[model samples]
Target: MGGVIGLDVGGANTKAVWRNGGERRAVSRPFEVWRDREALAAVLREVVAGVAPEPVEAVALTTTAELSDAFRTKREGVGFVLDAAEAALGGPPLFAFTTAGEVVPFAEVRARAPEVAAANWLASALAVAAVHPDALMIDVGSTTADVVPIAAGRVAATGRTDLDRLLAGELVYTGALRTNLAAIAPRVPVRDSSCPVASELFAISADVQLILGHLAPGAYTCATPDGRPATVEFARERVARLVCADAEQMAAEEIDAIAAFLHAEQVRQVEAAVRRVSGRFEVAPPVVPLGAGAFLAREAAEQLGRAVAELPW
Candidate 1:
């Protein structure tokens, strides 16, 4: 056997890992599947090519992209993604991990499409659980955050689906990027005064993180809200618009303050979810932070006074 490539195709990004003879390489690319579903095959091909020059022996697939608004139904989304993966990988032995924790063949996934939809979090959590017996997996991606509990070397998650995860406080919609500022808070402080935020898509979390120096211009893979450059200057300009104001109208320090406030609010939101999941375990477990926004996870863990374990990505 050559090696197995694991893929987690998401709505806003595509993540892949190539494992061969104990050597592994992982890569994530910005690919808005909803905006350009037809380009998925090309994106997949590019991602695979980045990690492995030769043909992969097999591919294990998982996805949250099927939940994108591009498809009318999840069945259609699953079929489309499977087709693209097949075409991109040249029909290598393919498998899809399901919410039931089963890796079924591509052919079997059609009948179990719902189970396979948005199950990437489960796959990640299970993989972590296999190594750490008692821990909380905090995966904060660009568009969402997952808080999954692992107890006794098993997945102690309460939710099997995204909806259920949301209800169970295991899934938080906030992330390191792409989240609307309006969703984070209705208003922000501006020099001792609270200013109402515009409900429009004026700014996203990426802009906030960019201005706060948490992310670099190149690290922001998602499209900017104003279709402007991802530079710190432009990001500051976007954050200024959250209050329906421009950079000229606000001082640089004022804009930075707003970004700092929003960043704290986001951390609070993720912390709430982390606390909810942590309550399930008898004793506090070490938090294993994963994904791009691992800093948020580490901060949340520190706030909860728990030990931290960084996931080797």
Candidate 2:
């Protein structure tokens, strides 16, 4: 088989996977489309080139970046992304994956653009279904967690669109790197007292994970809230600000304990969504964890006593 490229263009990142017969490769780059929509075509070309040295024979695309605030409407976002892909890939047989779990021609995608907007989760779930038959796909990325069920080798999701998925508990708006600490919990235990979290973006989940040694400094790719470094010392300082205090006001062990608390809180949030999504099935399915926050998925799975099938990505 010739080289076939699959792209998942997200709001904060662009990921590409190249499959050529027995060889397969993948690449992900931080390309916040809302920050610069004009650069998308260039970014796509760069990602494609990085994944596959040779020219690609065909292209399959899925996107959640359309929901980015860069565009006024979803239709406009869809059209812009489609145009960018065409510009980047030239004349390859282009296909778009829809929320319905089917790959349609680019012409169909343009005609029914709403069906394909933010459908990368469905595409990923379908891909996992083809291999596992019966499993739960949990993709915890930088900003969100997608809990999709795959039953009998098919995508068995309760909702299609982002809004619907959020309502159905299939989409949790918290992730590893970019999620705000305030969103994780309203109050966190500090020493002997429970302090209310400051309602500010002073720190993110990345800081919490970094302070707890869950993530390395280099692994925290998202920008810090205070525009500071992502090192452990800096992360501790960031977490201290969550309680409206500076690093000097708190001891190192106190900040570390807070980080541990927030990490467990985030895990609880994901575990709750997993239970809601998996409750629909008669028998519990093994969790297929994907993305950079696979550790969170594993923690949630262990809490539920479910088996884990780690994705090869």
Candidate 3:
């Protein structure tokens, strides 16, 4: 059952996908690199070990974890990630996927760490573009959203780095889960009146999604903002706290309304990013939604009158 393994080491989570013939298995581990940067190697070993039916042929790695604040510089972070992978999977051949679509061997990654840094979107876009020549791919993950455009069988991205991508509308900081509620909907409607939200991490987008039924309890994989259980009722309580209220003080329906509004705001964020990125193309292409916030991407694509290409990745 050994074929290949693909791993994404993100700022908030580490995900691995093992593809061997017809069997595909995935493993996801919540790992806040900023909390304990050195522990990443252990996490890498754990996730791969959990998902591997047997030792895979080779390991392909992409990273946005390099953008985490744990390291003083991106170079350090990239080197650290490479080091972790080397330490964890010394037996497996390690390769790094770059923004330019180069499969760099681990020996070369350190010399070209800058290009290997935060190139997860390109890795995904290139994989999708292999099938769909011209399309707009929206990947709304837990902490960020990527709007990648592929044209004529080439990766047609306007920006290569995170900073440049943000400016080019290829990256939207708002995501489905981990994002703070205060960053998006600064104000909320309550009791037929508008209320200013507390500029705090009282709630996150995951709570809104849970209450809005966009995500189920099991799908809320990360830890809650308040460290409470991930349940619809608890999500409602978290959403209520955004407006300086609680479950007992606010009606459940009102909380639901708040969740709906927050959900719309997040959808609006991705939609706006998609619009901006699509403007770079001569003719806007259809959409391909990916990641945890795919529902939000689909909503945005529908609003833009673009047909979604349902591809099994």
Query: In lDDT terms, which candidate is top?
Result: 2
Lowest lDDT 10-residue stretch of candidate 1:
304-313
**lDDT tens digits, residue span 234-263, model 2:** 888999999998888999999999999989
Per-model root-mean-square deviation over C-alphas = 1.3, 1.4, 1.4
Over 244-280, each residue of candidate 1 has an lDDT whose tens digit, in order, gives 8898999999999999999999899989998888877
TM-scores, all candidates, are 0.97, 0.96, 0.96
| lDDT (10s digit) by residue, model 3, range 1-313 | 6789999999999999998877788898889999998899999999999889577799999998988899888899999999999999988799999988899899977899999988999988987898899999899999789999999989889899899999999999988889999998778889899889999899999999988788989999999998999999998888888888999999999999888888888888888998888887789888989999989999999887889996775
Candidate 3 residues lying further than 4 Å off, grouped into runs, are 21-23
lDDT of 1 at 84: 92
Model 2 local distance difference test score? 0.90
Candidate 1 lDDT for residue 290: 88
Q: After the best TM-score superposition of candidate 2, give how far the Cα of residue 310 lies from its true spot, in angstroms.
A: 2.4
lDDT of 1 at 272: 96
